[model samples]
Target: MIQNQHLFHIPVMGTGHSIDTPIRIAHLGINSVVSVVDDMLCEKIRQHYSSVHNIAYQNIPKSAADGRAERITAYLNLMADIVGQKFDELKKMSLLEGTEKDRYFRLLPESNPLRKSYDKIASLTNQAVRQNLIKEITGKMTLGSIDVNIMAKVDALKMGDDGQPLSSEYSDASSALRGYANSKLSSSLVLSAGFNPRLYSYLSEFKDFYRDKTGDIKKKIILKVSDFRSALIQGKFLAKKGLEVAEFRIESGLNCGGHAFASDGYLLPVLLNEFREKRNQLKETFQPMIQSFYESQGWEYPELSEEETTPKITVQGGIGNNGEMRRLLEEYGMDATGWGSPFLLVPEATCVDELTSKVLANAAEKDLYLSNVSPLGVPFNNVRGTGSEKYTRELVEKGKPGSKCPKGFLVSNTEFTEEPICTASAEYQLLKINSIQESDISDEEKENQKNRVMDKTCLCTNLGTGSMIRLGIMKPSYGRQAICPGPNIAWFNREYSLDEMVDHIYGRRESLVPKERPHMFAKELTMYVDYINELAILADPEDAEWKKLLRMKKNLDAGMELCMEIAKGSSYEGENLHSLQSTVEEQKLRLAEIFNLVPSEA
Candidate 1:
């Protein structure tokens, strides 16, 4: 496998957290991904990057959308303008002369007192001039070669305005793939939100871009999976459609920020090892199936190169230090590791309100917890004490259950209306609260229901407006900011520059030196234990809860066994290892206590 020079990737944060993310990363000549959920912000960043830096910046923007031709078309049109505007600026810069040209070429010495200030200004001027010169000399402006990969979440694909599945012509995934097909600025389509056969079939229509002249795939498709089974299943499904995934991005369930999709109990280290061992077998099994599919469709089965068929394995979640980062890459053969929450501290790469960033920097372990704040019903990583959370509670105390719901992105509930409504909407929450009060249940249940209703925040606007509030650009009435940072943020106590973060990733420097931090495996186990306790509380005295508990116990047992194996084989012999062993033993005791509560199978 070809190891990337930029071995790290910045995964998609919320619409607000990663606003202008790519532009900042590109300024340092690094590869980065941007969230395109907020298309207007994406367009603005694209325009600014192209105009300021004459070189075509390669960025990946993730789209979580319903299949709308108009929506996809708007993004493409904006992209076209972004590219056109960049070249126009480059053309103007090509004609620079005198002091302007001199300043562009001149490199200020580090010893100069004003070097830092001058270098910042001159870097932009120098880069633009240099790019213009390269274009002039080569007589080739490869505008189309600009990288702009689009990420589409399969499960989140929106239906048409008529409340039907989008037609093939207007299908979101297909349109995005076809829109950029064969164009110089063509972007790869990354399929996320797990596997969907219909989405794969729709993409097969553009076989030309999906597969190259040599039968090798030209366009890249990345699948975000939580476990080996999901990866294998998705890989086989794609191969059956005569397609091969370029990468399998494995994310941790509870350790990540935003939507926390906790696994039944599958831990990260075990999942990685499984993938490492089965990767070759997986590729070998899928290749012929893909070839057979092509043959069945009366198409010539393209012989794929070794690299073309083999998908790179990548992991993200709770990766706090260079030691863990290096181990994942070197030990598991992972191609890339993602850093998301840490970048929130680096204002250069991610958007965070100054107040929110401070809150995150000063946050302790208890401050960051998984909560039912998302309107989507998914458990979201949330900060306990933020302006947004405080505002949400204040409104609840005042008998107002929900926010204004200005941008109705998460409005997909039909609980009270003929048309869909957001659960966090004032209309819906007010209705829900009244119903819960009248329900034939215990007072405890009523209180629990009320708390859940009040917990729902307007994540759509709250997530996007934090940076605007931090920059003193826009201030919403409900709150100034909301931040979603993973548990790992607690270990990193200070803000860092992008360079400092990169240095930490590459082991050049240690930016995060916490007094006490649990091993990643131990941390994951602890999360699972906490989750089990919560489940136990809500669990009924029935077969269903028993079955769930049994499954969880099985997974926990497997995870603990793996932890022991790691401890036995690991070279490190120190306090860290002792802490890991202690944590594992503690989890074992907790698991046993839960297991004892379960009724006997006999």
Candidate 2:
């Protein structure tokens, strides 16, 4: 019952990982989600593709903006100009007579023998006109249907060169939402983010809100949820606002790439089951609230058919092969599966450097680990021996602590001075390192803390550098690149063409992914166990760390129980069931040992 033809989407990888990704995917008649974190890159891509394809250009609101409204406005204006020029070109082409029209069409193809002559003539004749037209509309028009990410809270806010607060535009979640709304882009824009009530309130202020002309709200916004509880809370909140969510993007807490938001122990299968079983129950719970809201607003509630109202449930994270893809869609009734990290291996799909791509392909389990690398303070998934890490360590050895703070996208804290700064800024690191040295912790602990601080590279800049470097657009002084791939990426041992990857997804052909890779459920459980064990080693017995450990233990127990239930059922068979049972038992023993170490309550 998946309404959309696209059975898969490429999640926003990073600033540069998937730059211009939509263009490549759209060329192949596939819809792909590309990141708009870098505005210039987005504008360039839009300009290039506006004439060729009408693909949805998605943006991630990961790092905060300095002048979000102006930036977005400028972006829309540029797109309008490009789209306008495309229309003009089409009109001109249409006016061509029989032979001329045929010649033009023939020359349009790259394989045409006289394409060079046609390009020369067109460039000479229309270059000035196109440039003037673009200049005229570059700051005036508005565009529709761009996607934006609203990551619940600001991880880092960009600062002005003068060190004064940039416009209130970049201040908080509300400002970001308002910036998009005021630009008249809200109507067509898809607001995506984790569930946040404050953000919901801001979005509700829009005249159209989530409604379409047909009375049913359009499926434009995406909610990133790990479990049903979160989805229910978000759904009810939207219903109360007379708004409707189009999709619930279920991501695996620990099994995904980039920032790993480890769930309390809810596995992907368990969460998907809840959504499938209670999908309509959830809609029923929200329908009344939605009707009440519409009534209060003196508006008639648009009664939606079941087809329009049923929320699309899609899952991402650690999904590798055609088997897993088919199971998630057919067995679990998922609308689409997101293939993220694997897309990094397809040069046609992502902007990874040759060296970085090879490193990712050759990576093993040990190379990938959750580390305190992001300045956002999230548990980011990082690979070892990247240029970023090596450069960071070299800087630490040379008495420097942090990155150059080039692009201040991740700069939100002002802990070290009156001006807000990034935790990964050199100034902040020097001050923090000094303070940590004076703390009461052991020398070893202090050293470990310092290493953690230094480990944070300027991900904002480093992540974007891969594409620029690969395209020969910019060369960095560091001469190294950083890559963030989920542990699932380790199982993909070779580069893949986009067709091969797509084939793999639809069971046409299997490539890149290894046959012996463990089931995603087992991998996630093992990762959680490892994460808890690491926390235990660093956690003081009397601190809140103990409580965190307790929560993790509870989640692991829940996950184990769920796995056991699945093993006993008909969902899995043979090797899959054996792997599930064995992994659960192994994790259970490890959990028991950790639980025994916990001090009894008084």
Candidate 3:
């Protein structure tokens, strides 16, 4: 396992929010992931940083040969260079009070060795001894990794000017992978969403993914999975190709930001319990497969200890406070936890313009919801008063309800056009609306169908506009910024400095969330119940959808039972363990009513 100095890492936010996070915070020894979904956004940010640092700049035009991959490579290399320089400068500074070096040690967990050492050496009377110890500690300081993320399924096939589809290697995800593989970064590549066999196969081409003589993988693999079964399946597939999964980062489906990949009624606690109990099975099942592949290729399989070969299991999503974080790390045996949505409120961490930041800060629980805004048709965690929401709604009110489709990253629809166009595009919506109007269905049904068709917002461009607007790359008038923050953002009602946010994470100061906030486990459970209830209402009685809903109900019942046991176990102050018990009862009664009203499949 790669040794992370921090107990928690920031997962990738929208394509641009965390794009430059490494440059902002990696010198402080905090690991963060950058999204490589939009190469155009990357190129712009790279140009901005290059000019700021007075580095030589060159543009990779869209029509250039292998431009997507080249652009991503250039941006990542620039990021690596910038982060290294910043870290070197940070290490050279004296440990003066309130200095950057002081902030670095102060942000660390109280139990961390460096923090403890700094604490002990602060009161030393002998200047010579103190300076010696400080030098030794500074020499041991490591730079936080600048990891990159690729949504595995966001691989839209590109088209040449001649209108012919590009080769499979030129797809969105493939080019992004190649870009990362070619970069100088020695960090992990987090593959979120789901498995794409073609993308996984492409990993075999990159030698960095394999082990070297020192038994170290230069480029590691971290699969952001929702459950244990997914980990086993994808892990084994990669293992057969001699690619080891370094970590399985579990995230909540409905409770997370960005595109929600809702699981089949599998709650976070139940999922973590499975991984904790079956963690050994992962290594046991993959080691032989990897060894066999290595032997077949005449490669030396390094004789490493079991600890090095075993994959790290981590969890993220809706983790609000230290108590919940402790339960995830200690009780569930998670190696680390992820803190995403709350960082949207931390200006020192993520990129949020003044207008959008205020919206996220003042957003009530009712304002943050699971929305149908993604053109990909995935449920997205969205805030109420985003500029994108207002713009899209205004367009509808004016009888013109669709974007012009400038960027086609999420284009998957080929219904009306010979080539695929984004459903959020004006062309597609108009085509779809006309068909609905001419159909024989009732006016009410037509309106409902039209509403669903127009629900898709242009996420490919809008999601990244916040960063552009904040960085002065574009005017706020032209930037209809869309931000996806989880429901947990409701409790954090103000902007925070980087130190304040890190303090909240380490429990070094007062809690940032309110007392009325629900526990993470209970919050996820309630979401699953509400989700199934919605499906139950829409599902036809005799269809296969109803059967699926029945199975989800059974799974929720079992999950509630586990929640009850957890509530009875150990209670942390302000964690609201009692609320977990009450939520189980309340949601269970609601679930019973929904199912009772809908008949079971006969």
Which candidate wins on TM-score? 3
lDDT of 2: 0.67
* Number of colliding residue pairs in model 2: 0
Clashing pairs in 2: none
lDDT of 1 at 431: 91
Off by over 4 Å in 2: 1-3, 27-29, 40-67, 73-147, 155-195, 216-219, 476-480, 568-577, 597-602
Q: Give the better candidate number (1 or 3) by TM-score.
A: 3
- Candidate 3, lDDT over the whole model: 0.90
lDDT sort, best first: 3, 2, 1
- Model 3 scores worst on lDDT over the 10 consecutive residues at 593-602
Residue 101, model 1, lDDT:
22
Off by over 4 Å in 1: 1-3, 27-29, 40-188, 207-209, 214-218, 295-304, 470-480, 571-575, 597-602
The parts of candidate 3 lying over 4 Å away from their true place are: 597-602
**Per-residue lDDT of model 3, residues 76-118, tens digit only:** 9999999999988999898956689988888889878988888
Compose the digit string of candidate 1's lDDT tens values, residues 162-210. Answer: 6776556444445555554433333345555546576666667765435
Q: How many steric overlaps are in each model, in order?
A: 3, 0, 0
Clashes of 1: 3
